[model samples]
Target chain A: MSTAAIAALTAILLVGIASTVIGIVGHRARRTSDFLVASRNVGAGANAGAISGEYLSAASFLGIAGLVLSDGVDALWYPVGFTAGYLSLLLFVAAPLRRSGAYTVPDFAEVRLRSRGLRLVCTAFVLVIGWLYLLPQLQGAGLTVATVTGLPAWTGELGAGIVIVLSVMFGGMRSATFVQAFQYWLKLTAVTLPVIVALVYFLGSGHTYDRPAPPSFPERTTVDVHTGVTLQAGQDVTFTAAGRIDGRDVAPTEPQTWTAGSRHVVGEGTDLTFPAGSAVPVVAGGPVADDEWLLPLSGADPHQLLGIYSLIIATFLGTMGLPHVLVRFYTNPDGRAARRSAVYVLAMIGVFYLLVTLLGALSRFYTPQLLVGGQTDAAVLLLPTAVLGSGTAGAVLGGIVAAGAWAAFLSTSSGLVVSLAGVLSTDVLRGKRLSNFRFATVLAGAAPVALALGVTQLDFTETVALAFAVAASTFCPLLVLGVWWRGLTAKGAIAGVLAGGILAAGAVGVSLAGIAGTGVLGVLLYRPAIVSVPVAFATMIVVSVLTARERPTDVDAVMLRLHAPERLGLSRDAVSGRDRAELDEPAPDERAAGPA
Target chain B: MSTIEERRADTGTVYERVQAGPEFADLRRRLRRFVFPMSAAFLVWYLAYVLLASYAPEFMATKVAGNINVGIVVGLLQFVSTFAITTVYVRFANRHIDPAAERIRQQIEGPAR
Candidate 1:
């Protein structure tokens, strides 16, 4: 095995061991009163770490750098939108959500609306969003494992799926706080250390990207084609090929020429070697010149402005709507602690994304070969070996990065699995028994692995963004309206959530089916938030106004519950859905455990 | 777990009365004064930044100092604005929102604690 692969494998194993050891050591969710105040009484800072850990996921860790490499400055908005999401959460959702005393998103729906139907609908969306989000993470794991270990993608998916099921069943309900908080620091170090090293090395090397041509090979380079790519060259490139090129195979001894402005199809598993100074030929969609790449809106074709706006709306509003994200807020002890945790989260994730952005810019100099194969998602994974020359130190750094990527997948999938299990055990299965949660974890973890195994063409970050878009359309309206508006009724929420969910999911379906055509309409469909989000809010408001008589007479009481400060002695004890049945009421004394 | 008298004793009017009172009014107004305008302002600021990056590539690409382009600096300022807003709001909450809310809490919890 290559040293890079061996180091990466070892690093992944070590992270797994450390996470398990910490989780076992920190199992303290033991007493009822401790949890009557909150789960584990998780401090604001530690809860912030856990929130950032789960929130970062595959999209932030690997997808941000990939997008920046492929699309340039405009793509930096993904991370920006990601961090700014917390602002809305802080301003509006955080304190109110924590104060609502609901166990899950579905629980919040029931508590606010007093309708089982609304709760069920919210449960449906949570499952859809959770599975949609889970699939891409598993697919990303497959991609990284295939790149580093050269194993088939299914093994990665299967292996990750099993690890998540076992760990979540054993550690998730017991010691989740310690494991998730540790992961955030591990992920930060994983991305930051390599970034600092590469920065020093790159400055001394004096490489510049302002030239008129595409980035060139600094040395003789060979790129492995894991997926078929159509190379679009702006300048002439000559190479020796060992696999199918335009349906014609030549041995490694044969030299090939790809003339400028011409397209050549390189089949999967082909290895092409480029001589030094050979201009890089980008894949079909990306810009081939450094000049085109360094500017904004150059890489995205058709409707660049509309696309950017749609992406902006999805990420900024979609953040608080994510099911996993909302559950993290519930871990905070009180409404005040929830708000404080959000601020800490903003700083933590913001710092991490800045380092991610720097690495993406650096990948232009170090791992330019990724542009050729259209596998830029590997940019962060392959960067250390590329910059530091694949030696012992480089291999160790590569291992750390690979391990970090595994950590991203592991932490995120477990969070999703635990969430899905919460909903399933309480609402779908027998009841909220420990055995039911364990059984549901296996189901939740397996379904996505099964889907990821069948789906091969998934783009790592864009798929996650699609899930975010759906969440933005559905729950962004529900929560924002539910918290701030008293006119919202069960009928209104159901209609609005259904309308938004269907429209958003339809847009995703059309785009994934490759029929979202190349026109203004296509841009609208591919990035639908600019259109769907307004429709959702409008539907909720209109339907809500029409059904105002159906509004729960207890609206003021619920609003007071959501908005009142914790010191007011009004809020009920938070019931974690992991162990408690959804409709089961907390004992009156526990509810009256109010101010004291 | 619930009976008609227990439901009657639910004391729903107390919450309604408290929610209707002047201190609660001040509390709600205080929170809205900070959050609504601040949320709108930051969202508008972020939207403006996004729109500029989309519409005006040349302006974004203009260099400022030492290879740092206007685009990157503006991007970094998004970070700055986010952090700055967080700091400002935390201060606002500690000084303005929390104190008034605390006053109301003491009134509501009188002899109840």
Candidate 2:
């Protein structure tokens, strides 16, 4: 086996073992409260670590660098949008939602709106968004494992799925909090150390950073293609090929020159040698010159104003709505701790994103071959070896990165699955027993793994962004208006959620099916948040105004509970205590008043 | 205190009275004072950055220093601004919002020790 592969295998194994051990060690959850919300006793710093850990999915760890490497400065919007989402959370949703004392988004919806139907609607969207988010993490695991070990993609997906399901099923939220917190530090060390090493080495070598165009090979470079790739070259050139090119097989012992400015097909299991100073043939998308790459929003196609706006809107508003992220806020002891944890999350996520962006920019110089192979996602994994020349240090760094990637997949997928299980067992399956939770965990974790095995073509970050867009459209309005506005009727919420969820989810569906043509329709469908979010908010407001009489009788009490801090010596504890008692009894009318 | 507890036990009256009381009002005002304006300003600043990046490409690409263009600086500042906002809000909340809220809580739930 290759040294890098061995290192990656070791990393994956260590991550899996460490997470499972942590899950077992922290397995003290004996009640529903422990399983669902960690008994709401987590402190600020640890919860912050767990929050950042789960929030930085494969999309942030691997996809950001890949996006930056391929798309250039415009891609920086993703990291910015991601981190700033927490700022929005800290300012608006964090404390209020925690004060509401809901375990899941659906719990919040039902508790605040006093409607079973809205809860059901929220449950469905939570499942959809959770599964949508889970798909990419699964696919990314498959891709990472394949890149490192040359194994079939499904093996990695299956491995990550099993590890996540086992740990989550064992301890649920209580264990997940500790596991995710550990993962935060693991991922930080994983990405940051190698990047610092690479940067110092790069600077010490006195490499030129002033290149005015798309990256070219700094010297003779050989790229091995594990899968077939179609590439477009910008200029005529000659190179050595020891594999199949353009459906014609070339003997390994023989070398051939190829013409540029035309499409060339490199078959699986081929090696292509490129001379120094030659432009890397663009794959996966069109060729981008260096000048366009360095400029914001000017790469290749140049007119993505609408797309950029859509991304900004989706991410800025979407963070508060993610099921995994929201559930963490429930682990905080009080509303104040929720807010404090968010502050810590902002710092943690911001620092991590800064490091990943640096890695992305550096990959352009070190791993341009990833662009050629249409495997930019591997840039983070392959960068160490690329820069340090495949020695012991490079293998160790690659191993650490591999471990980080595994941590990303495990932490995120486990969070999503646990939240999904909480909602499913509590709401849909009507199962309060721990065994039922385990069954729901398997069900929740299995669907995404199955879907991921079949759907491998979607870009990880883009798919995750779609999930965010859906959340932004559906839940952002729900939480914001639910917390701040009292005129929100259950009927209006129902209508708004339906309108927004359907529109945005339909856009995602159409985009996924590849039915939206590459025109205005496609752009709109690919990023429906700009239109869908407004439509939802307006629907909610107009409908609420029209149906004001349909507002819940308990709206005033719920508002007081949400906005009033726990320290405010109000009836919050009395209400919460009563709510908990009502929950234990489980009467139909009292169920809505119980802790969700 | 017993009367207060009894009043609070009467379904919604305790919260309603607290909501109308000076401490709760001060708490609400303090929280809203920070969150509302801060959210608006941040959103506007963020949107401006996005708009500039999308619509004003050349201006964003203009070099600010050696090898550091306007876009890079602005992107870095986005991170800086997030940290700055977080630090400022944390400090502000500790001093302004937390105290008011704590006072209200004391009025209702009594002292923490």
Candidate 3:
């Protein structure tokens, strides 16, 4: 077996063992509270780590570097937007959300709006967003394993899906939290160590980026195409080939010349050699030339400005509505703790993203071959091997990064599955038994895995961004209005959610169906948040004002519960002095009366 | 609707008492004061950055320091400003919001003893 395969297998095994160990350690989570929100006793630091772990999905770990390598300086917006999302959460949503004491977004919706119908609608959107987010993670796992092990993609997806399902089923929120927190540190160390070594090597090698030109192969390099790809050659080049070119089988005995300024189809298992100082070919639809790559909004597309603005809007407003992320805030002991944890999350995610952006920039200088192979997502996984070659150091660093990627997939997918299962078991199934939760876990994980196995065309970052846009359109309006504005009647909420959810989901569907043509309309469909979010908000406000009589009479009480700090003692289950004493001691009768 | 009203009535006295109190009003004012202005400022700043990066690429690409352009510097400052805002808000909450909220809690709970 190749070193890459061995390294990748070791990484997967280590992740599996780590998760199992954590599940065993946190095996005592029997109550529904433990299952759903870890008994709401988590500290700020640990919760922050877990939140960071789950938040940095495969998109952040692999896709960001890939985007930076492929798309240029404009891609920096992704990391910036992602980390800045927590700032919005910290400022607006964190404390109030925790103080509201809702276990899920749907629960919050039901409580704040006092409507079961709106709760159900919120639940459906939660599932949609969770599954949408899960798709890229599963697909990214497939891509990572394929890049590292040369194995077929489906194996990795299935492996990640099964592991996440088992772990979530075994210990629910408690185990998932512990495992995710540990994975955060593991991912940090993995990326940090390899980049440090690479940086040292780079400084010693004394390579400079002083030239004003696009990237070229520093030495003769041969790239094996594991899947068929069409290459857009820039200049005439003759290279040795050992596989099918343009649907004709080519023997390993002879060399072939690829003409410049035309597209050529290279079949699977082809090894193409490019001599030193040759410019790398573009991957058909991917970015071109360093000038366009280095400059923001200059990438041969007219809709670039619209795309950037929409992306910013979606990511900026969307994070508070992510089901997995919102549920993590519930694990905090109180509103103050929740706010503190958000602070820590901002710090941790900020430092990690800085390192990730650096890795993306370095990948350009080190692994431009990924850009040519149309596998820029492998830029992170391939950097160690590219710089250090296949020696002991390379294999070890490669194994570490591979493990980090697995942890990314595992933590994120587990968080999503846990949130999905909680919503299903609690709301849809109306069965809170552990058995029902486990069953929901299986169901929640199955659809995404099946979809991931069949679909392979979407970019990882773009898929995740679509989920964000939908969430921004749907729940951002709901939460902002429900929390701050007393005029948000139930009828208005339903109209808003339906309008936003349908429009955004339809845009995604159109884009997915490949029916969107390249122009303003196409760009709007591709990035719908700019238009759809305002439409949802406006529809909600207008409908609410028209149906003002339908507003809940208890809006004052619900708003008090949400905005009042924990120190306010205004929570629904507030105990009298005697009851507080009984609760503290937990006598037999008190134990019996405790939450089920 | 009847069931909802019954549930509301169960907690009605406490909600009414809290809402009637001055401390609760003070707490609301303090929180709104901190969040409203902060949120507006941050949104405006973020939108400006996005618009500039999209439409004013030449400005964003101008060199700020050696090997660092204005865009990269501004991007890094985004992180810095986030941390700064978080620190300031945490301090603000601890000093102003928490004490007022604590007073209201004591009043609603009718004395810790």
Candidate 4:
């Protein structure tokens, strides 16, 4: 039939295939370990693939393309921060957290701090991060589907939410692992194949690429583009069909034609436009400009130094706190295996990022027309179609890309839903049955779906970044201190986590409530990580020092477990909670057990 | 849950039939040395990527592909390098580390020949 029908069928078929695959794998691997950590038996290749799958979410694949297409060079930070964040995961948190043998972040908190209260606090952070991260993925799905099929945006998002929830409910982590790993290759193939084919098509077409035109009014003689522009978010703005400028009709058809400093004056009542090729500078108002919320602090003003750095810190520090991401480490056989897994994940994440940048840049160059609707989310598909010609080959390539996008979202979302369910069941509904855990999964999945549905009005990037900031502020510091320092007390952890999480989440809530966007409150409210991370770190350290009496005596044992890989094998089975305390210090039991 | 606990306790009796073998401690020491430093180095390398990405964006944005750019190259390579590292890690672990750890564990806890 039509393009919309083709796109719709492609989206549904991809999700269906993915869900079926996960269900089959998850059903076969049905065990606690499989459900939670993939049986701690995942191989390097598979784990690497799964890591790629989990890592390349809508943000990486779609958001980066949009950013790069919309803004030159500066948008590179998204991929950089995203890929590099894993490095932070490798160094400060990986091995030690893994060595603790905890299945989730809250589990680590409990083991490190020896307090159930701390576990609950960490559990809260995990849920927050999961939901925050979930929102963007959902929003992204909406944008992608709506662009591809001309369907209502919510239709795509809600459908995605349902599929992801079903996948998680059916398979849990074990299945998600296989699905994610498989999806990575699928994603790579989808993105790269299209790029290669499209490149060939463009070159084969015999058109010498034109140099970008001078920034000015579009050539008045070119096809009139004066139709009222409708933003994907459903906002509208009117523009003159053609403007008479310098003795000819100038229509702003191509961005490449814009000069460095050209400006456009809309009609008396109309708004403004950058020169055709000028940075699509996101002004403070209008549909596109609203991403200022995403930028948070224009710390460098036209430069975004603080906002960029804040994002960097968030992604770098934030990875440690991501529950689903962290839970994957536990599936490795031991602490050393966990560390190796992190390294592998980092490498895989890095490679896919290169492709993401290409896609982003190509969208602006090849599909500048789509930029009007901020169709960067659909660039991977649109660019290929534009280059390959709207034919069967293009449709096939588009379908493959669509499948990758679905897989990326489904895998990560399933992972999140599973982890959220696990934590909530164990920590919130302690002593609950398996059914209760499943119920938690439904609850956890549904909340984000509701939030995603409600907040369809906001910019996708900003919602996602707020999630990252909260993750960075609340859980990142908690994990860093919990793993590295001996002085991290249960009371301290509880206090620090609550303080950091509350402050950050509160700031986000206040900002979302339409408070004035001017001074100190705005900065703190918008970019809470700069404020919250340090506060969490300081609070943990200070509180721990004050509450040393409650400290575990096995500091030395814990250190050995964390650092010494020698006695790490089966002896770990001998290590008890009390032994952990003894490891941390010269306990009375050290004398009782005598020398090894 | 109780049955699983009981079965686990029954399994504990088997530990008595096993004895630590002569090669166990030495193998443990060797495996520990190999795995620890290798893992530590990779961890350091991984951390360096993050530090570079976070603190050094300007350097990253330099080009590698036509316009693909170094930042993009480095970012994508992160995923590739991680897999390569992981494959090597697993090969090393299976060949050098796991067999040793298993040998040591079996000597201490597995039934004796």
Candidate 5:
């Protein structure tokens, strides 16, 4: 096996063993006296770390860099929206959500609207969003492993899936908020070290960025195309080729000419050695030159403006609706702490994303071959060895990057599974047993594992944005109106959620099914948040107004609970509302004695 | 609906009374007054950045410094504004919102705090 592969394997194994051990230990403590107390002890800084850990998924770690490498400066919007989304969350929902005393998104729906039916619908939506979000993380894992190990993607995917399942099953998610917190620091150290080192190297290497042109190989470099790709050649280039080029075999010693503006198809496993200072041949549909890359809205599609708006709306508003995100707020001691936690989250993740963007930029000079191969997602993983060569130091650094990527996958996937299983065990199965929770966990991780293994690999960040669109469409309206507007009825919320969920999820369904057409129709269909968000808001407001009589008479009390200070003693959490395992599922007999 | 009403009667009129009073109104008003205007302000700021990014590509590509452009600066500022707003909001919450809420809670829920 290759040194890069060994380092990556060791990294994955280390993260797996550590997390599972932590999970087992955390579960044992929670089964006894320590769980309930641990919930309230989560400090703002540490909780923020945990939140950031779970929040920075495969998309933030790998996808942003890849998109930036491929699409140019316009891609920075993804990370910006991602970080800025927290600002809205902090302003509008942070304190109120914690004050509302609802742990999960579904729990909040039931708490605010006082509707079981709405809760059930929300349960379904949570599962949908969770699954949609989980798919990309799993796919990202497969991509990372396949890029490193050069093994079939299924092997890496299955390995990551097993680790995630095992960790969550051992009860790592609910009790050990600190484990996720540790993951954040681990990820930070992992990615940060390589990036800082690489940045220094790039600066000292005396490379200049003044020329507005396609990135050329800095040295005599040989790149193997693992998959068939159409290259958009910028200038006439002569390359020694082995394997099929334009459907004919070129011997290793023979030099082949690729004309400028000509689309050249290089078949799988073709090795092309390009001499230094030659203009790079980018993959078809990628930005070919630095000038086109540096400029925003220079995307190939005519409707890119609308697409950016839709993307902004999805990510900016979507943070509040994430299931795993809100569950962490319950761990905060009070509403104030929750708000504080959010601020810290913004700070922590903001720094992390800035670093991530830097990595994306640095990948330009170090690993531009990824641009040709159209697997820019592997840019971070391969950058170390690409710069440092395939020696001991490079392998060790590569291992760190690979481990960080694994942590991203493991933390986010496990968090999703925990929340999904939280909904499933409590709402779906109607059971209080730990076994039921374990079964729910299995179902949660297993379904996405199957889907991730089965589906075609997509641009990781874009797929994640689609999940955000679904969230923004459905739950953004629900949380916003339910907190701010008194007229928000259960039936109205149900209508809005259904309308938004169906429309946004329908769009995801269309795109995932590969029916996405180009231009206006396609961009709108792909990132439908701008349309779906407004439609959901209007539907809820109109329905709420029309059915004013159906409004719950106890709106004042619920509002008081939601908006009032935790110090006021009016905003006590219902036993059924929290994700606390001691108070979780099949309510304790004494609390269950209370009449509806 | 009747079942919910029945449960409300059992809990009695404390919450409704609290919700109706001026203290609670003032508290809610204070929060809404801060968050609404602030949310709008930052969103507009963010929107300006996004719009300039999309419509004014030539402008966005203008280099402000060595290897830095208008687009990159504005994007980084989005980060700065977010952190600044967070700090300012926390200060506002601590000074303006918390003490009043604490006073009201002490008045109603006793001096346990």
Candidate 6:
């Protein structure tokens, strides 16, 4: 069969498997309880695996690989931050969150604050983060499909979106748990198998591939800029004079080369064609100063500081607020189970990161030709082919990379769609009604698809990073404060969620309108997580302190419930689905022990 | 003070009436205060990791892992330490926490009398 046929077959088979599992689970799930938290019966190992599967997504698996490949050594932090974010989840929020007896974050807000308004605000934040996260999963699917079959990107996105909607809308968390758990292993196999095969292929080639040597620095002359518009004085901006790589002038091909003085031409009349693989050393002639390390952070030029910050904030905090990630914890039998799952997730993620770094380093050395378009995202896909040469060996390797991409999109999208479906039923539909749940799932799938199609042209990693920054800004603070601080009030949560969510949303909205890079602060604040997260945490603390009187009177009791282990049985009834109404009235002896 | 003591006597009678051992009742008081804050501390430490990663990348960029960098090492440690912490928690639960909780549960339920 052709590659398209094979991929289509695989897609159908996987979706069929997911649908069957959901069908079995969904039939028995008649109540709101089943749809929200899977009746709280999942075991530790399975939950951990599912969480890992969900959390890995396109971002963790492919995005990290892509990042490490392009950004040299600094990119390793992406996976580190992604994994470590869970430690924060485990240490502070897991047990208390479980004990709260709330299905979603909004439920916790409403119940804790006794305010519908607070619930609505939180619901809005969840929707924004969920949508932002989902967009990349779709984009990933599109890219993967395009890579594999030479088909349109929309074909893969639409195919994956349709599958997710059908399965999740009908199935809910009970279904999502099984599929996500299975996908983790599939993803691992998909990624690791190709690398192993490629390694073998590399060996068979007699270990004699011509590895491109690093550019020699001593012979190359660079031009130093004595006068330029200084963002920070004393920080030298050295432009490279016209130079040759393989006997061709490399400077005209890379305007950002040490060749251009303080300025490069932009807009219609400017020269555009540049040699794709040419590397320009940005800070080559200077003693690089403070914050000079983050030159790509500037939105004014992709070469500025804010650009780097944007990428960092998105990747670092995005791990925390991912829907699929949070939902993975729900599959754990208890809070402790959730915490342990996160632990295992970290280990698994750490190992893959090692390989990612190697792949990145190899790409930098061997495949300078591929970097010509600055299509760093395509490095991992192209690496295998580049190594194997354009033969069946290359096709097989490319196919494997393509499969990995598909897994990233499918796994992450399913997790996100499931979470969105649940939120839609709970928040948008105002109850966990089954029909509403189905509608929410469709909306979840369709909205992202529409957004993906509308913005078919975008930098995949950059767009996804923006989503992460927004997520970190919004939910990270909310989940952290909600679980740990007893003084956290409904108003504070609402304020923080709004402050962070709105700021990030506003940044995204403005960027979409092409208002980015207009000014320095505009560039700095373009990736709002740097500003928004602090604002969020501060908003929560300030509002919470001011509204201390309205803080839950049973905060102490709730804290006890959250802290007490499942072994303690204080909150066992909560996890075991023994509703408060069914809980036997405590005898005097037991009553003396606690109000929790 | 007299009225409070009287109220306690009545409540104490109810405990006996329900057949809950005094030990079960006492466990609730002891365990709540101990576990609540302790767990909360861990959660705070975990959140700090998120805050540091999200808000403090400059600090993370410092080298630690031989081009792996400080941010990468610390972030990766979050995953490694999570499993370590969970293992510690599970062991802690099984050895001391779970057994105490189970004992209380049994005592309160009292084998259906």
DockQ leader: 2
What local lDDT does model 2 show for residue A549? Answer: 94
Across A1-596, the per-residue lDDT of candidate 6 in tens digits comes to 55433543465345445554654555444444455566566776676666767777666666666655445434545665565456545544555666666656776665456678887877777787788778878877776666556678788788878877776666667666766667777667666765676556545644321222221112232322221212111212232234333224445534433332232312221222323333322222221221222211211243334444555555555565766565555555655466556656666666666666566545544454332233456566667656766566666656656665665666677778777777777667764346777788888889989888876333455566677778878777877777657789888888888898888888876765545455456654456677888888999899999998988765654554454445333343332332232334432322233222
lDDT of 6 at A545: 97
Cα-based RMSD of candidate 5: 4.4
Deviation (Å) of A54 in candidate 4 = 1.8
Local accuracy of candidate 1 as per-residue lDDT tens digits, A1-596 = 88888988888778777766654455543333232223435778888888888888888889889888878777787888887877777777777777787767787888899999998888888988899899888887888788787888787788778877777766664366567778889899999989999999999987766656888888899988877888888798888989998988878997998888888898989999999888888886676787677766666376777887888889888888887787776666555666688788888999999999889989988899988778888899989988887789999999989888888888888788878887887678855445666788888898898878765554578888888889999999999999988899999999999998999989887876656476788777778899889999999999999998999988888998787777454565445434344334563433333221
Better of 1 and 3 by TM-score: 1
Q: Report the C-alpha displacement of residue A229, candidate 1, in angstroms.
A: 3.5
- Candidates in order, TM-scores: namely 0.92, 0.90, 0.91, 0.74, 0.92, 0.72
lDDT (Cα) of model 3: 0.80
True contacts kept of 6: 0.17
What candidate 5 gets wrong by more than 4 Å, as runs, is A26-38, A219-230, A240-256, A262-273, A576-596, B1-11, B111-113
Interface DockQ of candidate 4:
0.11
Model 3: per-residue Cα lDDT over B1-113, one tens digit each: 24334545576877877877777788878888988898788778777777887769889878765446777777778778878888889889988987777776666555555
Error of 3 at A88 (Å): 1.3
The DockQ scores of all candidates, in the order shown, are 0.49, 0.50, 0.41, 0.11, 0.48, 0.16
- Candidate 3 Cα errors over 4 Å, as ranges: A222-272, A284-287, A513-516, A567-569, A572-596, B1-14, B20-22, B64-66
iRMS of every model, one decimal?
3.5, 2.9, 4.5, 8.8, 4.4, 9.3
Model 2 reproduces a share of the real contacts of 0.61
**lDDT tens digits by residue: candidate 3, A328-359:** 98777766677788789888888888777778
Every candidate's CA RMSD: 3.5, 4.4, 4.5, 9.6, 4.4, 9.4
- Candidate 6 Cα outliers beyond 4 Å, as residue runs: A1-32, A197-320, A456-461, A512-514, A518-523, A567-596, B1-113
Where model 4 places Cα greater than 4 Å from the true spot, the runs are A24-30, A202-303, A335-340, A456-462, A510-526, A566-596, B1-113
Q: Candidate 2 on A1-596: residue-level lDDT in tens?
A: 78988988899999999998787676855656667677677778899999999999999999999988887777888989888887887778877777776767887887888899999999999998999999889888998899888899899999999988888888888889889999999999999988899899877876554455557787898888867887777556567778888898887566665455577888988898888988787663443565556667664444377787888889989988899988787777766676678778888998899899889888988888788877788889888888887778888989999999999999999999989998888788887467888999999999998888775456688889999999999999999999989899998998998999999999998877646557566777888889999999999999999999998888878888787766343323212443355254443432233233
Per-model TM-score (chain A alone): 0.92, 0.91, 0.91, 0.80, 0.92, 0.76
